[model samples]
Target chain A: MREMIKMVVVLTVLSSFSGGLLAAIRNNTKERIEYQQLKFVKGPAIRSILEGCSNDPIVDRFKIKDGDVEHSFFVGVFDGKPSTVALESFGKGFGGNIGVMVGVNVKEDTIVGVGVTTHSETPGVGSRAKTEPDFTAQFQGLPLKKEFKVKADGGQVDALSGATVTSRGVSAALTDAAGIYERVKPQLMEKLKTFAN
Target chain B: MAKTLTQEFVKGLWDEIPPFRLVLGLCPTLAVTKTVENGIGMGLATTFVLVFSNILVSALRKIIPSKVRIACFIIVIATFVTVVELLMQAFTYPLFLKLGIFIPLIVVNCIVLGRAEAFASKNSVLASTADGLGIGVGFTLALGALGGVREILGNGTFLGKTVFGPAFQPFTFMVEAPGAFVCLGLMLCLMNLVGKK
Candidate 1:
């Protein structure tokens, strides 16, 4: 019993120290990490989808609260108007969660572009969702009211060859984005007003 | 003591080199070697974890009870891996994205835990640090070679740069899963052949 207590105490102390050390490192690098993620992982897709924006989307980003969740909106001033915004929505993917960035031209009630922000899909197979522009290009100009689904499921978009599951994941993410946009349209519009000034 | 310390370092470079002589840490070895860039990133991230964990484990070896030492070692290792993950996300976001999933997966990597148990827990801190460095360099070299071969044959490029002429037909198979296994197998056979002498 005494030995058991000693073992537990030692383990606890060690774990606490480890936890504290990690927390320190995390806090120290938090800002730089957010910047890196924005610049590299999410930046390219956001830029490609929201091209021709006068302001940097990453810098002009804001978050809105809808109940417990906070949704990030990247404001794009295109043609000298902050009428476009991109937001992330997630859905089940072949390997894990797939994050899709849906760019909305709020005034037009249509998607400006769609890009895969993050995904764990198989490389060269399901990962075509990220690398292959042709797959994502189909999302452009899609009306907010349109139901997004792969052609195999009787929808318009053609799925990537040999990556049907990933295709479905992308479609599902876009569908989810449509719903999110509908729910947050009023707040999103209000936020866009701030970026314009 | 001095000779043994030197031995610990030298052994990891060849006699016990990972994914080749030891046949350990095969997950990242196979996954990240798709590109030399990814291989080097994964290798360095892993080395950072290995070195720090080994040092911490060795420093605390005398105080830790044998009964729950594994738990303690895991805690130490996990903290280091998280630190690596966070730092990489901050400083090297592109590489971080390229080696996605594999970064966090380093927590469960056998090499880190294996070193803590088989070496750091018993050895002096200096010796353990040397061991970590040697093993890390070896892992990096092996991964780099594998990635170089795959990239060259599969894409007719070296580190994403065009090496072969436009007319050169890529082998294609070299970048695929089967090719990773075959290449590693052939490399191991060659190492064995050389070792026999």
Candidate 2:
């Protein structure tokens, strides 16, 4: 009985100590980890989409609350005008959710660029959605208000040859991006105004 | 028989090296040793966990009851692993992405639990620390060497730099899964041959 009590007490104390330590470390690292994730995972897509823009999109960012979800928008400055905003959205892909970053020209409502940020698509096949510039290049200059779909679905976009599912995934993500852009445009414009210098 | 502090420390470098001599913790040794940078990063992360967990286990050796000692060790080790994971994510996000899942898997690493159960539990705090550091360094060196061999042969690069001229074709097989097994086998064989003296 004494051994059992001791064991229980020891395990309880150890677990509590561990929990407290982890909580403290997590609290300290939360913001930094979030920033690091942005810089590495999403930074490349944002940079590519906002190519030739004067400012760093990763640093100059803002968030807007749309219903229950909070969406982050990265602002891009061209010729000193903060006219482009990059937003991320997800779509079910060949393997899992594909994260797509869509850069839009606020005044024109046209896409400046579209890049894949994350996906679990198969290499050399579905993964080409992220790798081949030709595929993503097709989305450039297209209006953001329309629904995007691959050629197979009777849409304007041409799908990659052997990666129809991945191409469809990217198209779906862009369509989702279009909805998110329309929903958050007012708040996004308001946030971008602050970056205009 | 009692080992002196120097012996305890030095033995881990060669006589009881985790992957090569002790023949333990082969999971990360094979999985993340595709690049020198990744190998070093993983080794350092494991080292941090091993050292801290050893210290904590040694400190709490008396308080932890034998019946629940394994549970206590796990909690302690897991806390440190979480700490390492958080730190890696916060600072080394790229490496964190590369070493994804494997970092969390450190909790189950035999070298860590084996030390906690065999050495740290019986030794003084200072001695356990030395053992951890020694073993950690040994693991790091072994991994670095393995990664160097694979990266140079497989990718024709060393630490991302081209080791051979542009004309040279890389032996891509060295970086794949079957290649890992073959490389590890050859390395183990070489270690045995050298140690035979």
Candidate 3:
């Protein structure tokens, strides 16, 4: 009887209080979290890519068309131009998952910007390289026709002094983003045309 | 058993060390300990959760039922993790972002869960609280050791500043995943050697 009573007490304390608190907060804040994610993480990328146009939320899996990637992103339209797109790329790095926010200008066939959405790089080397302007600046203003390579390989970009592997991983992610944007560029342009009308 | 609460708290310093001796929570210990600051942050957050949850769980262990006890425990842990996440976001947003999923992932950190199962679930509330404090501090210290070595060697710095002179080039490997294993492995071996004494 004592054991049974103890178990009853344990379960009630665990469930009734903590569980109730989390459930209440989750229910109360669900909409706010959803709104913030939309406004902060995605919103800036959308505006940057399309330059002041709004977009339909991109889904990984849809009722009609499934979004293929795990992280969801949207495409934006502006004045009959599909100027920008936001997508996440996961690359295996020296450590683990390196998720990056890649924004591209489809019209120019160039990258708009790349930001570290999430990464597990080594603190002083690989992680630092991610934000180093010299490393990141290499992506900016280069059109689709330009070769993406470290100057060591006869390309324009200079690799970080010691973080080549991480830089390569990030650059590979950039290349992948460019490739993906190429595929959907046409549909994105069409969506913008409709919006302009 | 006759020791005061201060002794109970201080015992986590050597005996019952969470990471080295108990070997309880190795995931985040391995995953994020590339720097001492990162480890410290993770450790403190985890300790807060462990102390609070242990106290609450012991207090309520008499009232809970048997069949759904595991689910109930998870709910309690998850709530505290969420609370820490919110508090970090409001105050330490940068560090909050740096911690990333590891914050929520603390819900599964075996140290907190293990104590809940081994001590808090069975012992008096005061004893459980003491145990929680001991284990939590021990884990923090372990993380700090790992983080310290990696930060110093990999970047020639400690806690975001250059501690070593400019001439000391960093060993890149020390900050990588392999470094986490090698450093911890070496530390473990050193610890075992000391234990034999």
lDDT assessment of candidate 2: 0.92
Question: If the candidates were sorted by their lDDT against the true structure, best first, what order would they fall in?
Answer: 2, 1, 3
Which segments of candidate 2 are over 4 A away from where they belong?
A: none
DockQ of each: 0.70, 0.91, 0.20
On residues B85-186, what C-alpha lDDT tens digit does candidate 3 reach at each position?
Answer: 766655555676678889999999988888887778777789878878887888888899889999999988899999988799899999999998899889
Across A1-197, the per-residue lDDT of candidate 1 in tens digits comes to 98899898998888888788888998999988887778787898899988988999998888887778888889899888898999998978899999998898999889899889888889889898998888888878879764688899999879999988888888888888888788888888877787775
The true-versus-predicted C-alpha distance at residue A165 of model 1, in Å, is 12
Decreasing DockQ order of the candidates: 2, 1, 3
True contacts kept of 2: 1.00
- After the best TM-score superposition of candidate 1, give how far the Cα of residue A147 lies from its true spot, in angstroms: 9.1
Candidate 3, residues A1-197, lDDT tens digits: the string is 87777667766655577667866777666655555555555554444444565445343111111257434445555554445656766666678867666766666777766665567888989886555656665666676442356666666667787877676667666666665556655655555454343
Q: Compared with the true structure, what per-residue lDDT tens digits does model 2 show for residues B1-197?
A: 38787888899899998998888999999999999999999999999999999999999898888888898999999999999999999998999999999999999999999999999999999999999999999999999999999999999999999999999998999998888889989999999999997
What is the C-alpha lDDT profile of model 1 across B129-157, one tens digit per residue?
A: 99998898888889999999999999899
Look at candidate 3 and tell me the lDDT of residue B68: 58
Poorly placed runs, candidate 3 (over 4 Å): A1-16, A23-197, B1-4, B66-68
